[model samples]
Target: MTALTLENFLPYRLSIASNAVSDAVASAYRALFGLKIPEWRLVTILAEGGAMSQQALCGRTRMDKVTVSRAAIALSERGLISRASNPGDQRSHLLTLSKAGWELYEEVAPKALELERQVFAGFSDAERQLLREMLDRIETAVERLEAKG
Candidate 1:
């Protein structure tokens, strides 16, 4: 029989590590670009995937609908992103990177990459690859459980 200790739980440890990393990078993003983590995520995703509806953004970002909506609204208000009528979905609007959004992405992407490099500087290439694969496996496991429920 194993004693249950929250500190020793793999899920707890993963959550703690995730929060710590997010917090550290979030501070840099806020300081450098005045963008919150959610806003930065939307910008990065849109830059890579082009215009998408809020529902699609939620799936692509693994963010809740409300969070994605709020980020979209914020970005739109700032003129970084634009919202347009979605021809395919009347209930949803498509979000696209405006000229300003593209400009901001261009500026932020390099800094974001540099921050990523710094965070993984202690990790070897193999370690990083393994960590990423482990995360993907964890996500898959979670999705499997979610699908069951």
Candidate 2:
């Protein structure tokens, strides 16, 4: 059997890289917009996808219910997002960005894109695309394993 080594493990490497990138981005988001990664994610999703219940946000974001609920509460408290009774399901509330939220998104999206470009500056477009494809495949593989488990 092969000796286990953390440095040689793909999952370890993947996690380290992911944490480093997320930390950098999180720092920037906090500094520039006072938004945590999850909060920004919810804002962006609501901006793009329109009103959605917390359950739907969880599905769309792959964030757990607690994280989504906390972000939704924070955004709502800030007046960045407003909650309304879901017409489809009165038991659940749908969250939608307020005008302030739209305004914030417009300002943040460009900075986010610029940050992305800076992160991948040395990589060509094709390389970036390939990386994305590989990440998608990895997610799919993990999901398959999870389903089996």
Candidate 3:
């Protein structure tokens, strides 16, 4: 029988590495902007895509509705984001970054790139591209498996 060791398991190792990087990024975001990971995710998504509903954000960010809602609420409270009634849907509001939020995003973007550089300093451009491809492939495989189930 083949013995299963979690330490040697690919999924387990990936999860651990992902969490480690997430924690590091979370710490920097919290310290610099008082933003949690979910909030930062929402901000980045909104920055790139403009107005969107929380449901849309959830789908785009792969975050649950509850997490997206909480982040939206926090950002609204900070005056970093605003929610306007959706023209097409009365039940859902579209969220957008306020001017202040845009300014914050400008500040955060460079810091984020710097953090990524610090974390992946050893990787060459090709290696980084390959890693991204591998991760994308893994995500595609997992999605296919999920669909099958």
Candidate 4:
């Protein structure tokens, strides 16, 4: 039988590392902009992808619908994002960053990138690329497994 240990498990280690990075990013965003992880994710995605539906945001971010909905409601209340009628689906509205949100994003983006650099400061450019590729491969493998089920 194969020996199993949580500490040595690939998924466990990945989750731990991911949480550490997310915590660091979340703390900085909260301190600088009073935004949580979900809210920041929405802002970043909207800034990059332009207006999109909540469902699309969920698919892009891989975040659950409830989390996305709460973030959208919070951002809308703060006047950081606006909701417009979706042409194809009247029941759903498209979300976009407001002028204020864009201004905040402009300030936040550089800081976020700098924080990412800090997190991976010891890694070489090649190592970073490899890390990205490895993550993509893991995701692809997971998709295949899920599709088989």
Ranking by TM-score: 4, 3, 1, 2
Model 4 collision count: 0
Q: Write the per-residue lDDT of candidate 2 for residues 46-130, one digit (tens) a residue.
A: 9899999999999889999999999999998899999998989989999999999999999999999998999899999999999
Q: Please rank every candidate by lDDT, starting with the best.
A: 4, 3, 2, 1
Model 4 regions lying over 4 Å from their true place:
none
lDDT of 1 by residue, 55-113 (tens): 99999999998999889989999999998999998988889999999999999999988
Candidate 4 lDDT over 51-117, as tens digits, reads 9999999999999999999999999999999999999999999999999999989999999999999
**In model 3, which regions exceed 4 Å deviation?**
none
RMSD of 4: 0.8
**lDDT tens per residue, model 3, 7-79:** 9999999999999999999999999899999999999999999999999999899999999999999999999
**lDDT at residue 31 of model 3 (Cα atoms):** 95
User: What's each prediction's TM-score?
Assistant: 0.96, 0.95, 0.96, 0.97
- Weakest lDDT window of 10 consecutive positions for candidate 3: 58-67
Of the two candidates 3 and 4, the one with more favorable lDDT, higher being better, is 4
Model 3 scores a C-alpha lDDT of 0.96
TM-score of 1: 0.96
Q: Backbone collision count in every prediction?
A: 0, 0, 0, 0
Q: Mind sharing the TM-score for model 2?
A: 0.95
